[model samples]
Target: MTTVIEVQNLTKRYKDKRALDNVSLSLEEGAIYGLLGRNGAGKTTLMSILTAQNFASSGEVRVFGEQPYENARVLDRVCFVRESQKYPDDAYPRHAFKAASLFFRNWDQGLADQLIEQFQLPMKQTIKKLSRGQLSAVGVIIGLASRADLTFFDEPYLGLDAVARQIFYDRLLEDYAEHPRTIILSSHLIDEVANLIEKVIVIDNGRILLDDDTDAVRDRAVTVVGDAEKVDAWASGREVLHRESLGRVASITVLGGVSADERAEITASGLDLAPVSLQQLIVRLTQKAESATKVIAVKEGVR
Candidate 1:
């Protein structure tokens, strides 16, 4: 696999807030990545810097083994379709496609036409007059059809309904299977794209929390359900990400993989084990990080 993107100690600051803090990661040429994080967790900021739409405050970033800022060679191979993508008020969908055709060397008009028709986008209407869902369809179409070596889809399902979103996901996976390229998907709908992405990069508080294969991430944690007393006893010395209790029943999610023996022991102890979904794991991880930060802040304040 070829390294297409490399970042070393990348940091971005705005005013007093640090959007990206010493982030370092590398991406290979042919894999779909899910850039998962909460709102304001630096997902957009990082993407902006990678695509040359924004500058990093400090540290180095290399796309295609070269700087992306003001570098047309690197920029031409990258497609960034963000929720807040802007266009001329008078520009129609066709104009956007025409411009994209000129920019992306691998632009596929056939795919773009299929998407537009499936999305039922109004070609004659000005971009500004299109509804939110229609506007999102335009971005989705462009992102999928551009066939850029590296494409970023930042919340591309903005106003799309469940069915429409499914279409986007289906087409994305189908296209990716045929055309192997690096794709970075930034979305809040984790479970929806969990199966699509090969790798997962989780960002929280401007820091890289988890960057690993999707299958490995799935095995990071497991949940146990049983009587409150038994559940607590089992989770006593373990890292518990989350816990819920209802009457005499309790459910506890803990960090660490369960071995075959451990699974047998858990079941024999009258506890049922449940698999944690990617969305659930991420939510717990972010909450845990936030709590730790609060504790650290309190400790500093005491000093």
Candidate 2:
């Protein structure tokens, strides 16, 4: 598996704040990745820097083994689609698709046409006059049809309804199966794309919180439920992400996978294990980071 993008000790700061602080990660070719994080958690910042739309304040970044900044060879193979994608003042849907066709090396007119029809996009209307969902569809069509070797979609489903969003997903998966490439998707709709991504990279407060295979990430934590005392006993000394207690029963989510023996012990104790949703796990992790930051800030203020 060739490395498609690599960042080492990268930092991007704006005035007095750091958008990305010493972040590092490597993305392999032909893998779908979910770049998950809370709002203002550097997901967009990281993507912008990777695509050369923004520069890093320090450290290194390499795309396809070469720096991406002003590198047409590398840039042409990468396509970035975001909610705020802009076009010329008089541009129309056809204009955007035509331009994308000219830019992306592997541009497929047939795929673009298919998507436009499926999305029922109006070809003649000026882009500025199109509805929000239509605007999003333009980006989605370009992103999927461009077939760029590396693509980044930052909230590409912004104004799309459930059905349209599913269309995008279904088409993306279908095309990806026929033509495998690296794709980095950043979205607030975590559970929506949870099953689509092969790997997960979580960022929080300008730092890498978690990065691993999607399945392995799920196994990073487990939820146990039943008697409060038994649950506490089993979870004691472990990294607990969240816990809930009602009467004598408790539901505790703790870090680390349980072995078969551990499962047997849990069963013997009359405890039940439940699956944790990816969105829930990510929310808890980011919230935990936020709480810790507040605590540190409070301590510094006291000093």
Candidate 3:
């Protein structure tokens, strides 16, 4: 796998707020990545810096082995589909498509036409006149049809219904299989895109909290359900993220994976293992980090 993007000690600040802080990560070619977090997390800031749409206050960002800012060779290979993407007041859907075709060397007109029909887009209607969902469809169409080596879709499904979102996912997967490229999807819909992305990158409060393979990240935590006493004993000495007990039954979410031997031991001990959801794990992790920070601040105040 070739490295397509590299960020080292990247940080961005706006007055008193930090949008991205000491973040560094690498992305390889031909893989789907999920950029996930809460609304104010640094997902968008990170993406914007990588695509050269925004500047970082400190550190370095490289796409395709070169700085992306004002670099046409690098910019031409990248496509960023933002929910708030701007268009001329008089420009129609057709005009947007035409502009994209002119910019992207690998643009597929057939794919764009098919997506227009599937999304039921109005080519003649001005962009400002289209509904929110229709406008989202226009961006989705362009993102998929552009076929850029690196594409970023930042909440590109805004206002799209479940069925419409499903269409976007289906077409994206099909096309990706035929022509593999690096894709970074920044979405709040975690579970919906979980099965589609191979890796996950999470940010919280302007810092990177987690970055790992989707499956490996899932295995980082597990829940054990059974007798309270037995579950408590097994959970002892392990980092516990969450725990709940109802009568004699207890469900404990812990911060580690169970090995095969441990699995057999768990079954022998009359405990049941259940998988943790990505959304749940990430929420707990971020909450835990925030709690730790608060504790440190309180201790410093005492000093």
Q: What's the lDDT for residue 62 in model 2?
A: 99
Each candidate's lDDT (Cα)? 0.96, 0.92, 0.93
Question: Which structure is stronger by lDDT: 2 or 3?
Answer: 3
Most accurate candidate by TM-score: 1
Clashing pairs in 3: none
Q: For residues 1-303, write the lDDT of model 3, one tens digit per residue.
A: 899999999999999999998999999999999999999898888999999999999999989999999999999999999879999999999999999999999999999999999888888899999999999999999999999999999998999989889999999999999999999999889999999999999999889889899999999999999999999999999998888899999999999988999999999988999999998898888888888889999999999
Candidate 3 TM-score, true structure as reference: 0.96
Q: Backbone clashes in each candidate structure, one number apiece?
A: 0, 0, 0
State in Å the error of residue 84, model 3.
1.1
- What is the C-alpha lDDT profile of model 1 across 1-303, one tens digit per residue? 899999999999999999999999999999999999998999999999999999999999999999999999999999999989999988999999999999999999999999998999999899999999999999999999999999999999999999899999999999999998999999878999999999999999899999999999999999999999999999999999999999999999999999999999999999999999999999999999999999999999999
Between 1 and 3, whose lDDT is larger?
1
Candidate 1 residue pairs in clash (backbone atoms < 3 Å): none
TM for every model, in the order presented, reads: 0.99, 0.97, 0.96
Cα lDDT, model 1, residue 43: 97
TM-score, model 1 to reference: 0.99
Ten residues in sequence with the least summed lDDT for candidate 1: 82-91
Worst 10 residues of 3 by lDDT: 284-293
